[model samples]
Target: MRLLTRFCSSFPQQTTSVGARRGGINTHNTNRHYNSLNASSSSAADQVPVLDPSSLSPSLTRGIHVFNCPDEVGIVAKLSECIASKGGNILAAEIFVPHKKQTFYQRSEFIFNPANWPRAQMDEDFLKISTRFKAVRSVVRVPDLDPIHKIVVLASKQDHCLVDLLHGWQDGKLPVDIKCVISNHERGPNTHIMRFLERHGIPYHHLGTTKDDKREEGILNLVQDTDFLVLARYMQVLSANFLKAYGKDVINIHHGLLPSFKGGNPSKQAFEAGVKLIGATAHFVTKELDEGPIIEQMVDTVSHRDNLLTYVQKSQNLEKQCLAKAIKSYCQLRVLPYEQNRTVVF
Candidate 1:
């Protein structure tokens, strides 16, 4: 994927008299960056260029692009040639191709001097290459150096998952802007957790549920300014209307293997069923409760001695890990919808 450029020009000259001319050129470079970073083709090798990063500006914009092609190795070489030729440098890349599938997939990040090269010309050049390779999909964006995605986390009483996410955001491990943290409980019995958010200058919304639709309404209002929602063990079941309103914009982490042990106290259910494995699943919220498409999952082995308490503790750990991964994927634009599931094109 290549970043395409859009340009705008303005003239400040009067057109009344023939000799009354006095206009200066005003140009605006509105370059739209493409995130799909992949290249293919037998002759693409001619496009790659070699560059020294030290020669470029310190504040360079970065972007990722992906391409789907069966034989991408040759294309990768060609793409490298193109970037090198244009004084652009590839920072990172990853490729994937299933054994039974004939198609190929690739994700690559690159740095370029937008001031000099601009996006429009780059897009045109990339389109020529894409046409030759018959690329499937492409996306491009300037990596958000400062808060990009606005996220609102909803939790019932659990603090482990929420706490981990908060820490990740504060430390810059997760690239997102956590607009607020909404809970059905008033900080529960854990005052330390409340202090943590306050210390970080992060706002907290404690709208305790009461009458009918109160919790739903509160959540809807809180998330009105947010781009995405994360249900970090937010125990209440969302109504059909809520699901329809948010749809794929909401992500939930369940303390169960999902499609198996769903609903209240999943750890207890797994223990009672004598299952050998207990796990956690992170997925998008749908009208069918835990039946939504999964984004990430983690499992842990259990023995007969493991009781409900032990299983719950283990599942909590798994939940924290899974939810964090899912959130990261969303911020990076790596997760894509694939039928009733997700395709994390990492």
Candidate 2:
């Protein structure tokens, strides 16, 4: 997948907008450094750092921080200094400021040793900075600190995206923990996909939409603790009330270039239009119907040689890849919601 670019908190007192030079550093050490405020009554000024910088391990845990606030000077300098003072090493950083909105956006990944840097204290310090800047932010500490995002995928008769995600998760290509697969099938269970899921020890639920079946309600019950919901080729329109209950973490895959060729038979629409480009879009589901923040999109060339059937076949392939890519990016905490119903995936 193409590495798309651009893509959290509170504040406290005793913080000044001090200037510090900003530079980049690359390292692989997984150790996190932390010191607690309550661990000692002595001021931070009085305490000495006992860590021998050279003795630190090579592997490091990643802590990703995202910030959105009004555009200003010295924000990066202050943030970098705060992290450095806490013994955190910057790994990767990206920033953007929209001219029209005048909002500053930053996404940064840092590495630190927990034994040296107390996680609680680090949070407190970051919170202080956030409050000072009047910013909204989220901090995700990966591998050790952040919880594995639990996902429940919903699919219907179509199974290409579902199957691709299963294979990716089984092969360790997808990192999130998939809790279960829920399907709303009025007819019956799909034996092919069910058998594959059973072989992999993944739970499968077939919620039939018969008169006596409370399938939609049952599906809502299954989503209680899930971090997000994936609509993998699930051919049902979610009700606005259901979406409000689920929050904005629902992801959907559309089979054609969005803002055009939307709704059913998108491939047929594209063929009818004689469009040379066919694409798939993976986006967050909103009440607006296929008009949500797009996380990932992929397209390919089509021609007169391609008929309706061929167009659909090619578009289905793109759908699988695009949806999987969006899910993986989200699981890694690389997707950020931006203004104007857009997204930044790093």
Candidate 3:
């Protein structure tokens, strides 16, 4: 492999916001155990058949790299050359070069032989490229090797979104290790939610919050080791202090199209407005209430025939599915927060 370390090191210094530790990589474990969590079901889910990751050739280990840097020429060429030098084959790649931001973003998937390009050397090779470009973010993920992302789900009385996430996790649709489920509302002893969590060995916490005590401290302690947090139709607004202390990504699902009917009873708001289309938006939760960066949105047509109840039902269905889709995309490393509360979903 071409050791471009010396050449890359010669480049002049620039401000770097790269999140990975120097000389190392940003690697996270993906919760892909559902493939084995339900071994029999896995076979049927893939009736059409596809490449089995377990059966991959020992010479071909899959790797995905996400790169962000200043917009400049030859970035892609250099990245491709790096992988090629390491005896890696690029299977798929996507790059985003925007006009206003003058920045570069890329997600590249490749396969290589660890026997030839050991993991440490592979990271070094990519680190060289990242330095050469003065990248803001440069990270690689080996899904097969990384552990599942650990997360906690927060919800209120609403159970639709929560239940869908549970099923998705059970079936392996979501590659996440749900550390626990937290809610402000209490559940009875024999409830299905309580029982399923009990059977799976997932912990559950019920917090009672008032203005005086939002119980963010206890919640923070519960999620201290988690990679991220999810609000599945969670009703309470998180305080700025809570978000600052958490200092990690928090995703929330909104029942209405954002920048539209924003607050509570959005369905009612849309229904009264006589809108033509209603939608659900799943986005990152910032301190600014429902105004965070959006990841995925699902919309459907509304008509005069639809009543307030119908609107709510339709919105609930959309909300459950949209949130799950966003979480899946996030676990797959396809959702990236971008400039001005936007997202670059690859």
TM-score of each: 0.71, 0.79, 0.82
* Cα lDDT of model 1 by residue, 1-346, tens digit: 1111111012121111101111222113221112212323256474334344456577666655666554433566666666667777776665444334445555667897777557766677667767777876555555633348788888888788988998898899987888888888886435877888878777888887764655787678778877788888888888889866754378888887678988888877778888887788887777787887777777889898877788778888999998898788766756543223435335
Q: Alpha-carbon error at 297 in model 3, in Å?
A: 1.2
Off by over 4 Å in 1: 1-61, 67-85, 95-105, 117-137, 144-147, 188-190
Candidate 2, residue 112: the lDDT equals 85
Poorest lDDT segment (10 consecutive residues) of candidate 3: 1-10
Q: Per-residue CA lDDT of candidate 3, range 1-346, in tens?
A: 0000010112222321122212223223222221132245456775434345568687688988888898766676788789888887666565555435667777777788888888888889899999998987788777777777899999989788999999899998898999999999999879989999999999999998886888888999899998889999888889999988988888889977786888788888889999988999888777777887777888998899988888899999999988888878777667654665555676
Give the higher-TM-score candidate: 2 or 3.
3
C-alpha lDDT of candidate 3 relative to the true structure: 0.76
Candidate 1 deviation (Cα RMSD): 14.5
Candidate 1 lands at a TM-score of: 0.71
Best-first order by lDDT: 3, 2, 1
